[model samples]
Target: MTAPHPQAARHVRAVAVQPHWSAQDFVTAAAFRRWMRAQLDMARPHLNENGVNLVVLTELNGLPLVMRGGAWALRLRTFERVALALFLARLPRTLPILLRERVSPVRALQLADIDANTDLYLTTCRDLAREYGVYLCCGSAPTPRYERRSARLCRQPGLLTNQTVLLDPNGDLIGVTDKVHLTPDEEAGGVDLTPGALGDLRVFPTPAGDLGVAISLDAFRADVIGTLAAQGCTVLLQPDANGAPWTAKEGLPPDPANLRDQPEAWLESSWQVTAQRQIPYAVNPMVVGNLLDLTFDGQSAITGPAEEAPAPRSYVLTAPRPGFLALAPWVTSGEPPALREAGRHRAALSGHPMENQYREATLHADLTLPPATRPAPPRTPHEDALHALLRGEARAARPGRWPWVLAALPLALLARPLWRRRRA
Candidate 1:
């Protein structure tokens, strides 16, 4: 069967694939190396003859497609890989095979040198992209670079420029596109990346299918996604980087979840336009830290139509282990308590959007799916009073508190006076 356009394939599906890595996989040398190899072997079968896999690789947006694959087997320290050979005597047969994934004349870096490691990291990306048929997103350094100090440096005009293209099986590109949006002081690696101008947009032909690509983060905003949707792009690849240091969700002042919200928000809009247009979206996974762990997360995904509705089942794979996640398109049974709390924070609640819907996407993008943005939490009477007292501009649609305050004020005042008179 042939799709009229990528947009024509809205009856697509969204699927999530990820590898579960045990913590022990990190500490033990022999055991960890063996596990990494097993992971690669597991993933290799899904590859095409050209090394491409059905997985959808992307970020916010990008123009063309690329392919790659590789691996790195390093211990916590230099001595670990060179002399100590900590757990080698006990490693399984799988260990040697895993090292082949990464053809390394290897280089090592500590956590402090993540930035310095950029050149080698990107070279690794280029190599993997060439070897694999699929666009292999590589390197554990400055990923999702959108949040990096270097990215913030891009804001100064003439400092940063980008383009987009669509590549074919022969590695010949069919289309070239540019970005449309750029914002100011966008947070990156504890700093901000500047903005730039719009780029080209159009379609290209491919042997497997026609592809439409959007190349950069800023370029793939709401307007651009809408435009691409209008033109009909079946498969989209967005390779973006955060460039920020890595840490768990609890560490940062502004949660990485907030940074994550940008793409998820766009996908809500883009996915709808994509579904309506019958196209699928391949969003590359964003990284949390620059540590060289190929632990793919839930970010990378595939979206298309389903027998019933378009949901996660369409997803193909997720990053393996100590990394991100990929989830199949499916709705949650109910909203979580946190979402319920957030809804109350909104100026208004209900009738919103999600990764799958328009309303769930409302101002807060991440909370769109599952437990639907919790309806504004039930107001506590004390909070109700505090709000009324603070409303030098408070316009709580709930007016009951006003009369309650008024009725109680007189009683409170009179009771005080009466008690004073009795005492006198």
Candidate 2:
């Protein structure tokens, strides 16, 4: 075989896409795929120079697609009206999950069509990986347990996790990892997602480097980053979606007294974590824009060790810090003063006319991997038992449904549809 491209052995070209969420883009599966393809198209110029080895997307990039058929709600501008439309549209499927899982309507809706959402998310990523001939990290989605026994997705019920999947250029899955840490909103609030077991954490081998993923909040936890670092993971990928204002005080600040804006806080957790762990590289891609009542904002970045100089093409932020290889421009140059005023009035900024201009961005960088570190030690028996205990607790928490008196109205509304279908 001809000698590999000179940069192939030591370096890999990677791109991080900062996608803007749009209900219109997710109106149909085809629209979602087209939107995904458009993201790559934005980086086509860089890909054309030489094939990029990897492309990273932000967390929950496909979650909004859970609204697949509820596009009619877009016409109703108010959050309450839109949510009610979605609940009614998805009632047939969501009601069963609501009663079975004893969850909020919003969470039930997520599980109601999870299989389709997961399929759309995976197939789109797989096809994109093959078409571009690059390793792809499709970000995370709320998915149930699934297996590929005969090259087909065999889904099973019982456990629902926020999962991230990695695929190679051949459209074959390299690995799948779940997010171990759950944010409060994801755990106790309307989302109510199950947390992944720490014992299941793993590193996947790739041409670029041994890849390890820590979705969103997991990246900030020392235990998660430390475990992966010890496992000889040279490159860390963090897929993020901040549901708060970009300039707001961080909810989980590293230092309460010396609080920072969300971007600075994110950098401390991501870039700083990689540096502390001694990982050669870290790529963080953030999802922006608003979905219903929730708004997400952040600057995507590629980071490395301080000693490794960033490429000339890398965009510098306010204070040029070491180890930041590349940074994507913020969706807005600066938060508009009117946004702050709107916040003071308890108004939803997502609905503002100016919010429609949220821009999507893609940042590219060539990362050079360092020599491998020592292998990680196997999990101890105690760790295994702890993982088992957590899983059991999660299962017990979803025990037989409690009575939902409020669901009677929705059930009555659906009675006509059920009668029509049965008569047919």
Best by TM-score: 2
> Where is model 2 more than 4 Å wrong at Cα?
1-9, 48-52, 78-84, 101-104, 148-154, 253-259, 311-318, 331-353, 370-424
lDDT digits (tens) for residues 122-164 of candidate 1: 3333333344444332211221111213112111111222333
What TM-scores do the predictions have?
Answer: 0.38, 0.78
Candidate 1 — worst ten consecutive residues by lDDT sum? 358-367
lDDT of 1 at 387: 25
| Cα lDDT for residue 417, candidate 1 | 12
Error of 2 at 48 (Å): 6.5
Per-residue lDDT of candidate 2, residues 17-67 (tens digit): 888776688879988999889877766665635644788888877766766
